[model samples]
Target: MGVVLAGGAGSRVGGADKGLLPLNGRPLVEHVVARLRPQCDRLLIVANRGLDDYADHAPAVHDETEGHAGPLAGLVAAFGFLACNRQALPRWLLTVPVDCPDPPRDLALRLHAALAADATACCAFARRTGKPQPLFAMYRVDDDPVEWRASARDALHEHGSAWRWHAALEAIGVGFDAPGDAFHNLNTPSDVDEYERAHAAS
Candidate 1:
């Protein structure tokens, strides 16, 4: 299953929903779904507001955790949703932030391949320019149900970020050297300006 994590409140962008922001005359969520659709058998979105709008692109989901627990909390909800929906669950869950409009074409393929080849790894993420992009990754299903949920809850309370959870899973990081910087995201106003300027120049 492919999950586009749009549950964030986009606090850094002045509390506006990042996925609904305009990019090239279309909602950014639309752009993200377009790119990820081809990579998975099923596409689902995770958004906190404007559920109907997001559902127009793909089925939308919500984070079960309280108090804006962030992306890790969103993933926990996604996993729980999948747990109840056994028939639609995929062996691996591919997640990308809704704000990233230009992910690499082979993003899912690379992460899936990396996790498959590594026996001990439960997650495989993108690493580029010597930096790790953990959220844009593929996670293999945890066979142990009880521990999985607990681990997620613990991570949400403890680190407040996905980094610790990624480490706990023994994740594998796949490297990329593409010049296009496919993982570029519109997380802030400056990012939007930089991307627009770059696009206009090109």
Candidate 2:
């Protein structure tokens, strides 16, 4: 299973919905979907707003909790959905933020390979510039998803949106400098413009 995290306050982006921002004349979510869809057997969209627009690209899903929680809330939503739909429970879940328009093509495969190689690893996450990208990661779904719900719930309660997902999952984060541009995200209107200009030059 693959999930796109489009639920965010976009605080740095002047409240603009990052996923809906246009890139190369298409929505940023469209670019993300093109990057991830080929790598997963199933795909889902997690967003707090713009459901109708996102639904046009994939099955739109929303967070279970209110207040536009964060990436953790999106995970809770994905896990809860998996719990209700038992058929996908056995599959691992790959997550990427919708703002990331240029994620690596083999992201899912790389994370899966990493997890398979390290049995003790609960999950595998990617990093760039020596910083962990928690939302760009994958997790094993062999266990009950209710545990994830509880984890997010506890984090939200104790931390009040200050909790980072890498801490929540105790993730085995991996950092690499992939060739060219990867992990480029659209967080601001200027970012969108920058991406367009750079991509056009390329």
Candidate 3:
């Protein structure tokens, strides 16, 4: 299933629901759904509050099971939901952040390609600077559910957060040159303005 991690409170955007934020007159989550729909047979939205808004757009809604637990919480929930629904677990889960409305147009296709080339490792988008964009990657859901739950508990103890998903994955970086600046996110009012200007020009 394709997953959009929309659980954050978006404190950076004046406490606005970033997923519901407008992008080219459509909800940012809609842009995400459009890009990801072609990639999976099912789509899941992982959110904290405002799950109804996401559910309005997605086929399924999986909230952070542990509450305010962060992205890893969302990941764990997605895995659990899938395990309960599908007879066999899927090989991978495609994840993207809610705020990034202009993620790579070919994100899903490229991630699948990367995974096919290297079955042992997962894939993540990387900027030219070589930093992994953790939220915009695909993860191999191979671990035991109990083990993942334990990891989530441990992460909550040490960092007061859920599992460190990026640190756990065997990540292969997918690099881009002249990476689309449109991927710049709407964190604040100024960022929204900048994105609007850039988006208008495109």
Candidate 4:
């Protein structure tokens, strides 16, 4: 399944909901969903607020547990939801932050191939600068359910950073080639400005 992490509080953007933020006249989440729809049989949206607004766009909506635990919380909730519904879980989950509009089109296919290349590997996308984009990654979900949930809880209680999620799973890095820099995310008003300039130029 493909999950869009739209539950963030967007504090970096002065409390604005980055997913709802408009980019080129459409909600950021809309762009993300459109990009990922072709890659998955089902779409699950993980949002903390305004989930109803996206109901028409995403097939289902899920929220994090109380205390604003963050993206890992969303993932855990998604896993539980799938388990409860008895849905056929995909081998890997393609996760993308709602704010990132131009994620690689072949993300799901590439990550699947990359993981298959190595027996013990998770795959994450990286910028040319070599910074790992944790949110834009595929995680192995079929292996150990107990350990995955425990690690998620620990990350929530301790720091709410998904870095632990990366550490728990053996991850490999995939890089985006040049001219695809439009994948830059909008975290603030200035970022929106930059996106506008760059998108308009394209």
Best candidate according to TM-score = 1
How displaced is residue 157 in candidate 4, in Å? 2.0
Give the Cα-based TM-score of candidate 1 against the true structure: 0.92
lDDT of 3: 0.70
Residue 126's lDDT within candidate 4 is 47
Give each model a TM-score.
Answer: 0.92, 0.91, 0.82, 0.87
Query: Candidate 1, 110: how far from true, in Å?
Result: 0.8
Query: How many Å off is the CA of 155 in candidate 1?
Result: 0.8
Winner on lDDT between 1 and 4 is: 1
Ten contiguous residues minimizing lDDT sum, candidate 3: 161-170
Runs in model 1 lying further than 4 Å from the true structure: 142-147
Candidate 4: residue 107 Cα off by (Å): 1.3
Off by over 4 Å in 2: 160-165
- Per-residue lDDT tens digits for candidate 4, residues 138-163, read 87777554555676677777777776
Candidate 4 Cα errors over 4 Å, as ranges:
122-127, 143-147, 178-183
lDDT score, candidate 4: 0.75
Q: Residue 90 error for model 2, in Å?
A: 4.1
Q: 107-129 in candidate 2: lDDT tens per residue?
A: 98888988998887778899778
Of the two candidates 3 and 4, the one with more favorable lDDT, higher being better, is 4
